[model samples]
Target: RAVLAAAGGVAAGGLTIGTAALLGGTGKGREPGGSPPEGEAAAAASEEAGTRAIADPVRRAGHLLRRAGFGGTPGDIAEFASLTPVEAADRLVDFEDMDNSGLEERIARANFNLTRLRGGDGRPGMASDMRAWWLTRMAYTARPLEERMTLIWHGLLTSELGKLGIPRTKFMLIQNELFRRMALPRYDDLLKAISRDPAMMVYLDTIQSSAAHPNENYARELMELFSMGVGNYTEQDVREAARAFTGWRLTAPPRVQLPEGASEAERRAAQDAAAEAYEPEFIIQPRLQDRGMKTFLGKTGPFGGDDIIDIIMSHDAPSRFIPVRLFREFVHANPGPETVAWLAEVWNGSGHDIREVVRAILKSAEFNSEAAYRAKIKSPVEFVVGAVRGLELETDFRATLRFWGPMGQTLFQPPNVAGWPGGPAWLASATLFARLNFLDAFLFPRGRPLRVEALLAREDAAGMVDEALRRLVDGVMSEGARAALVAHAESIRDPVERAATVAYLVLASPEYQLA
Candidate 1:
């Protein structure tokens, strides 16, 4: 419950619990917090003014939760709806003081150890196991934004469990934790850390890099994808930058090769010993490093990996590039020049502070506009995580992995270094059906009773449909969607079955797929 003082233009204690009153659909109203909500006439008078600026608390809260984190629960929405935009942004972005012992305890209780591999192409179901572990955190963590930012980094910085291999899976977890700890870190610091990060080193071939033959893989991606975007840096710059990062390698985890003719028990013992002895860490071999002056991005004088990152930060390209990508991730797929310019200003002014840039985007009028609401399709991860949180369901993360792959997203296994194509790419014919089938299974597993008794306060069909829509879709279902849901609910005479059916349909609806 530790809170920072409100930052930026929003005033303190300026919002009230008007969401309940608004969602009740009674036109009769007085503005909350003793300030009148901006009327449409006033809104019409200015480009920035709108009903969403200080009114439409529910939609505003939904937008925040959907983008800032995964979609939230009704309780999450209601609580967030009570805060002004800046206050809500503050609660999410400034989470350094928050106690996350509950999430830690849950993870401990699960006892998911990554080191235990089941053999063959690394570990069987290890990627799924990892996905489940993180999904649990996303569903139950106190700091949703932290988990959301971790996912964002995972997608953007891009690593694959398949590429990292099972023996090195622990390094992927290490990278994940790094993103969480520095979720709102300065851009320069994060780049510097990731450049030397053990998992990243292995994933991008930095481990194989040497002065004799500098591997340009990491260097190319560092400039083209990670920092300056494609085409901003030349092939020569990539070559020089690769030299700067030469000799970056990780400690070799011991591989136990059982002696021929050894008994099964003896082989097991050796494998166990190697597993226990393994310790992965980053190491720079001076002998393998290039010491001679190397020109990179027009700078010369024995630049190292850290120096290359520092030089990238010194340029405006990183400042412009990162904020724009972040804007698309959080706001909409397409960003106009004006939007980019505004966010870039925040980036520069805040010294490339991620939190400041994110806060600015969340608080901007663009984020709350109709153009951004449900504008992007839900990536499979978001859809699944949102469903679990929306229903307040307890789950075995392992079970979820089966559905995730067919539904077009498998955690820790992005298709390439560029990561998940996201947005409209998630809605292919086969994948869309997979999404529907997964929801059907999730809502009514094995045709058994639904697990949402705690979520339903009413038993009748109409009441149940309303509750489902309210809880799952931020109560923003269209009239046709509502009518369709109610019809489906009424078809089932049994109240629980009816409620579950309604929930399933809403989840399967096109509206739910958007966020």
Candidate 2:
């Protein structure tokens, strides 16, 4: 429905992306005071000689947007292009002040039924609806970094709606909201909160723990995945940590009162309404808790869950592991030791402040280096969201939300606790087929004309391709790819069809698959 409306809007001349917007006009790469900002200057000084900062405003802006958020549109790129690299990075990092009411309003208008749960007879789609809601936010939100960081946290401090049980699927949404609220929080605080998070407790089996038979799932993942990588802690540490976390449980939500004359269907409806309003809070049962002194990580005491988290945060491994994870996510797949060391220093000095660590990463010499530019493959979510955002198209994408499963990255349904393999693992032949087909549906939905006549208004076939390239991918195409796209566009006579085909070809090309 939204796609049809957008097409109508395009026919009515509502769609526009002028040449000035494409080139960024006065917006291309401004250095405040005609020099690198203070942090960027220091980062520049740290680089090897001849390792220049990204000079092209467009490339630098694209890199920043791709890493810090999903991909950016031409207008988004133009806005960032005008600022110094440090200024741009800071703008995204310090995002709390940004007005997000527009995105909020869109979400309100969607009118998603958050309380809908799968029935006992094997009904489904509520989880998919939740996934669609988030995808919509990613595609259209004014503050992409916040959503980006929320995604990073979701991948790391992971949970699964499937294991959360059919009745409690909406808890995943609650956990998602928590990630957004504390997206850039201090590392220790985030860990502590996750230890007490209801969804996480359920997913990791923290709620099933007892003093006599402590559940080690949460403790093992806490060290191996969340804080430090494996081998940093001994088996004893896992056992002791599990003991400390015993008695962490989920509280029962209040049930709805059924009227005497209520029918069975009405009773079920009332129960679901109550369930929607009820979010289980994390609680501790003192009777089941381990109060005995236990030695964990060489520290002997009556340590509780908070104490274990504190010990993990105080260790040096989190400083290294977390920065390495951040580096992998943003900079490159394999970061040099020096880069990791620099980021670890920032992590330690900033007292695990996520905003400061992310700021240093965005301003780092390595992040701006050529090796990091388009170096990683886009995850399934990134690929879909980037196209929508870059094309500036409108659509009620909830209908297509199921594409994530076959494309290989289903939200709230990661294959395992380790999360998606990402990188090259996302480009398997079947997945590539899925990507191409999905682009076809997106560019020309059900034979409806593309809302891209504005893209066709450029000079000719080559010009239209160039304009589409600039709008979709910051004109970073190779000569061969550009020639191929132009040739493809020239073959199609109808300008609207030519423009849509060119846009589709460019997006389907392998060049656009890398971030």
Candidate 3:
């Protein structure tokens, strides 16, 4: 209860600070200050009208890590702090060069149960296993941006397990792997691929769509939520695109041939075995396709689903819309037209290559600006995964799976087609408690040993407090907050308890609440 009260106080204060940051209030990053730091003059000169470059290397690197990937550890921060802003951006954006075999090996050693896990009654455990698998990847992947971009695609190119039951849940992992593989591909190519994605076909009713009676769900979301924002396309466009996307289907499992007079249990086991063996692949039935010319987005053609995607990719709206969405994900909300226009130019110039656009955004003056730092709230996944990565926690990630739903952002289970509402919606009172409760479970697991030995190694109470703040919150806190944390720490007698208490307070602090 005391911990909850502290979290509440810090949360209220953090919200005020976050709200102020959003409403154009100045932060330490924005204080009328010294001439732009040594190497940042050119970058500062290029800043958009209202934005200023972050001059401090530590803060700049910290901001980049939180936005570009998940949050970084002290070693990660130290390594990035040594690089120039452009170098740092390159390191993260060009992450294909990084050796991630360690993470792969870790995953293999973990031996996650991606297949069926049966309890007493033979209920499938794939959903929980899938969630643990993804969270573990987010927490421990060597190429953080890979997982981050995978998450972006998952949320934007939304699908849900709630709709796809246990029998079909494996498709979600297939879709997830697709996102990771094509994490930084051309927008058109990704759209074309997702059009045939088995999970997407099922999620948006694309499998049910036919030439005679087309389902409009995928088409509407493709334009409104996925590619182009609302108002860029119309009902006519949706109908046409739906017709163009007809006949999409997944390969079916081989029929189970049960012996005559077999019990219901035997039949059920055989069916489950078949489902487990099935590997979904996209296929098109020519008879169900609408090969006739149809007008879409002001152009008439005998367009298939890929053709519809190609057209959307070529449209002016997606060039702007995709950049705006990426900017919101990596920088902040409410980006000005000039910034969007600049990003759209990168999008168009690179032939809708997402890697080029992400590179431009990461290296841009706007990304490192004071306006972008701590400008957005962390989603629950970010909150948990960032903590896990930042603290270097070691677990299979099974325990953390249950907390995601209560915190309102479950993997493969977005509430609807639009994905999580995000931003301020993540910090509702109930969800806030859920986050704190997650920290409680994470920091103090019942049977496991405490995970704050490094923190406890600090010489004294103040050192421990500062270490926690530094590791989790970029080492900067208001004097009052710092003093309060130190005082709280000093009062605790046991070294282990003292370290955990301080760590909890810092993690619960409003400063840590924001990315």
Q: Write the per-residue lDDT of candidate 2 for residues 1-515, one digit (tens) a residue.
A: 12222222112432221222122211123221122224565445434322556778887898889888988888889999999988998999998889888888887887655567743444335776688789888888878889999999999999988788766787888889999999899999999998898889989999889998999999999999999999899999999999999998988877789879999999878877777768687789999999999998888999999999998899989988998898889877677787778888999999999989888989887787655666677898888888777877776577676577888988988888998888767877678668776777777789765867548678599999888788766686545456666766677888888878877776765556777
> What CA RMSD would you report for each candidate?
9.5, 8.9, 4.4
Worst 10 residues of 2 by lDDT: 18-27
Model 1 collision count: 0
Evaluated at residue 82, the lDDT of candidate 1 is 95
Error of 1 at 5 (Å): 49
Worst 10 residues of 3 by lDDT: 29-38
Give the runs in model 1 whose Cα sits over 4 Å from its true position.
Answer: 1-54, 119-125, 255-260, 263-269, 272-276
TM-score preference between candidates 1 and 3, better one: 3
Give the whole-model CA lDDT for all candidates, comma-separated: 0.75, 0.78, 0.80
Per-residue lDDT over 418-515 for candidate 3, one digit per residue giving the tens place of the 0 to 100 score: 88999888878778778878877877788333658668779699999888877887776656567777877888888887877777777776677777
What is the model-wide C-alpha lDDT for candidate 1? 0.75
